[model samples]
Target: MIHKILNNKCPHCDKGHIYREKNIYFNFRKPKMNKSCSHCGYAFEKEPGFFFGAMYVSYALGIAEAVAVFIIGTFFFENTFDLRILPWIAITILLLSSFNMRMARIIWIYLLKGV
Candidate 1:
């Protein structure tokens, strides 16, 4: 499960790339996508606005990440009321935004594929 999410492979074949580019860092501007899987020829676009559902998944992921940060800060930093953790958490989420978006789409595809 983790391997599939980490690699962002096509759920059908588990081989082809989903995004047009392998590097996630570069896609913010173009949001490039392949028409179909290179390996199995699976269509990435299920329907128009199919990825709209991915937004909700991404939102859930962001919330989960924030909650995790809060828990870890409370336990490890030993300070729930510490003001320093706010910016730290924000920075962490900022840095992880791209990775989280990528993973959220991957997870969303997996969820739809299983159904």
Candidate 2:
């Protein structure tokens, strides 16, 4: 599960490529997703609105990331209430938004693949 979520591969089989591009970083402008899995041939997108669930996944990931940053910053910086933390979090989210979007969709596909 962790591997599937983090690497964005088919949950049942890791050999398949969830996406067609070499990597997600440079492929943001054009996400070339395979219509079906290369290994298992599992359909990546079943129907319209299938990926809507990815929104929830994205929100969950964003919240988790924000909370993690808040906790780590509070622990190491020892700053109870620092306004800079807000900017830092915002920047982090902005930079990671692409990856978050892809991961969210991948997770959603994995969860609802059988359905």
Best by lDDT: 2
lDDT of 2 by residue, 1-115 (tens): 8766667677658888787766774344756778888898888888878888899998998998888888777866756877768877887788778888888888888778678
TM-scores for candidates 1 onward, in order: 0.83, 0.86
* 4-108: candidate 1 lDDT, tens digit per residue: 777778889988988766786424544566767899998877888888899988888888888888878887675667777788788777877887777777788
Per-candidate Cα RMSD to the true structure, in Å, reads 2.2, 1.9
lDDT assessment of candidate 2 = 0.79
The list of candidate 2 runs beyond 4 A from truth reads: 25-27, 76-78
lDDT of each: 0.78, 0.79
Worst window of 10 by summed lDDT in candidate 2: 22-31
On a 0 to 1 TM-score scale, where does candidate 1 land against the true structure?
0.83
Q: Give the lDDT of residue 26 in candidate 1.
A: 29
Distance from true position, residue 24, model 2, in Å?
Answer: 2.2
